[model samples]
Target: MPITDEIKKTLTDPTPLYALAGAGDLAYEKLREVPGKVEALAADRQGAQEMATAKLHEAQGLLAGAPAKVTEAVTALPTDLKVLQERAQGFALQQVARAVELAVRAKETYDELAERGKVVVDKARPQADSTQADAAQAVEPSDAAEPVAEPADPAEPIEAELLDEPPAPKKSKPRKSAPGVTE
Candidate 1:
């Protein structure tokens, strides 16, 4: 008769069709439960994202205030300029040595960071170049492509002009050979 009556009849009958009907009903019930489950998962993900964003903002705020906090702490320390200068003078030599060491270390650190940055930039350069080339290709007509102006060479040497005055006279030096070393 109707589809519902047919399904009911098939469910009641002792046949493979009856098992199929039961399975279909179970599948339908599962399908009905899916929206609620998906909504719950989405809400959980949204809440996690919001929490992460809040924590990121808090960390940024703290980092932004760090310099001011450091300044305040340094100013609060109980030491006058004259006393500090005298104390510094007492350890002047040691301080100079330490300063030299720190300078060398900072130079090494800067060199390492520069090298790493160069490598990263080198890796990205080809991709950026290709993207620019693609854009250029898209914009230019095929017939005019051959005549497209080439980029000026970046390593062109500067033209030197002659100076009006002659260079200063070189000073003479008295040279002596080392006793044990040959030159």
Candidate 2:
């Protein structure tokens, strides 16, 4: 429980103390990168200001053209509406045709799977019949007069099986070597 002088010296040894010293050196090197960060920050701020000015000019241009654009849209409204209605009707017909095509494809797939299932059943039918016939032949009476052992009583408890088993094997201990020279 007592701390000795040797323990104190080991804990205070400088050979193991350079981790913090190396860290301090690394921090000084990283501080050299600060000027680059400041430059980048200045460039970013200038870029953001230029982008804001350009967006303001673009917004002004749009504003100047707004009245003409509105007049053009109002004049062409009836023609645009008719075109949109025709497009919508065409889209509906196309969707119906696509649905019919998909239904036909699905029915084809179903029919193909049904045919495959029928082929598999036909191939397995003879094998199943032969196996059943073999099993029936095995169940027929045997000529040999071998004695049949009666089944153990189901009423017996589980402890009876455990009691009949042999004792478990013991773990072996390691042997001790003789003192002096080891080969």
The models' CA-based lDDT, in order, is: 0.75, 0.76
How far is 149's C-alpha from truth in model 2 (Å)?
20
| Tens digit per residue, CA lDDT, model 1, 72-98 | 999887678898787779799888999
Minimum summed lDDT over a 10-residue window in model 2 is located at 15-24
Per-model TM-score, in order, reads 0.31, 0.34
Residue 113 in candidate 2 has what lDDT?
A: 50
Give candidate 2 misplaced runs (Cα > 4 Å).
Answer: 1-79, 141-183
- Runs of candidate 1 with Cα error greater than 4 angstroms are 1-90, 144-183
Q: For candidate 2, give the lDDT of residue 169.
A: 95
The clash count of every prediction, one per candidate, is 0, 0
* lDDT score for residue 32 of model 2: 96
Q: Name the top lDDT candidate.
A: 2
